[model samples]
Target: MELRRITYENVDAVTSMSVRDEQQNFVAPNVASLAEAYVCVDNGYAVKAFALYEGDEPVGFVMLGLGYMGWSAPPCAEGSYCIVRFMIDQRYQGRGLGKKGMEACLEYLREKPLGSADKVWLSYEPENTAARELYHKLGFIENGEMCGEETAAVRDL
Candidate 1:
């Protein structure tokens, strides 16, 4: 599979992603109003945003944002930082696609020019332990901060 940018033409593929009722609970304003994916990809402010495509099919996606510089070095490295949003179509789950999407995010980070601000952060609903755990195993640590429907975590690069 390859991770590529999502276009207005790909909303169908993106909305086609699998999401559980509980997971859906975390996403709101419906797919149309959720600019989480659209905004990041269109704005250069984000690191990179892409869709995971298997052949000609898009099975999942993520939006990786480079964190800003400041007193946030320990959370990141020092110059550039990052975060991501990911999802797979419900019918596409259990095939380890989450790992694939995350691996791309990590690889994207690894390939960046080294700096103190080089790291990635992510947030998930406090009740979403599965996502929290996957992020943990991938090297994220809880930042002890929670907002709205989610809590935050960070991984130093």
Candidate 2:
């Protein structure tokens, strides 16, 4: 799988991607994420939104925040990167693409695409055991922090 920047040609496909019905409450929709990306850019913050692809098919979405320190409940230190939003479409959920996509995100962040950072942070609803498991397998340990109601976790770059 590969991460591709959202462009005019793929914007519709990206925005239309959806997670499973049961997971609707765990993540914001792609359109909302894109809107946040736009607002972040407008407000002078670094954000990268991408469409995850398997061959030519769009399978997931991820948005990254770089050096953002404006969280009302700061779960990460300044200069850290955050996986602000992530979701694999319902159609792609059981295909192991989530791990591949996350690996891609971490690879991208390790390059410091927006700026230098030594860690990557993410949060998930406490009840989302699937997410917590996946994140833990990917090396994210809960730091006993919260970003709003979500449990915060971090991993070294």
Candidate 3:
């Protein structure tokens, strides 16, 4: 799978992606994430919003905010990026796309302009065990922090 930048040609499909009912509370919709990305951009942060694709098909959306240096933003360690939002379409659930998409996100985050961070932060609702486990397997450890009602985790790059 490839994580391609969201573009006019595929924006519709990307915005249509949604998670399964049980997982809905774990993530926000793609449209909301895209809007937030724009806001981040206006604030001088480098935001990457991607449409995850399997060949020609859009499978999910992933958004990242690089070096969020805002004064009142969550306390991200210096030079850290955050996977602000990520989700697989409800129809695509159980196919391992989430894991694959996440791996792609990590790869994309590790390169130059976006990859200058020494760490990456992501958070999930404490009730979202699947997210917690997936992140743990990817080497993220609880940093004893919170993003609203979600517990935060960090992974060293």
Off by over 4 Å in 1: 28-44, 68-80, 113-116
Global lDDT of model 2: 0.89
Question: lDDT, candidate 1, residue 98?
Answer: 75
lDDT of 1 by residue, 27-81 (tens): 4422642365456446544445567776787887765555542213333322445
After best superposition, candidate 3 residue 106: deviation in angstroms?
A: 0.8
lDDT score, candidate 1, position 88: 70
Q: How many clashes in each candidate?
A: 13, 0, 0
Tens-place lDDT digits, model 3, residues 1-157: 8898788999999887777788888898889888878887888878778898978889988888776535344576457888888887888877888788899888877884565677899889999988888899899999888877889899976
Candidate 2 C-alpha lDDT tens digits along 1-157: 8899899999999989987778999999999999989988888889889999989999999999876635464647567899999999999897899999999999889899988889989999999988899999999999998888999999999
Between candidates 1 and 2, name the one with more favorable TM-score.
2
Superposed model 2: Cα runs more than 4 Å off: 75-77
Top candidate by lDDT: 2
Return the TM-score for each candidate structure: 0.73, 0.96, 0.91
Q: What is the C-alpha RMSD of each candidate to the true structure, in Å?
A: 4.3, 1.1, 1.7
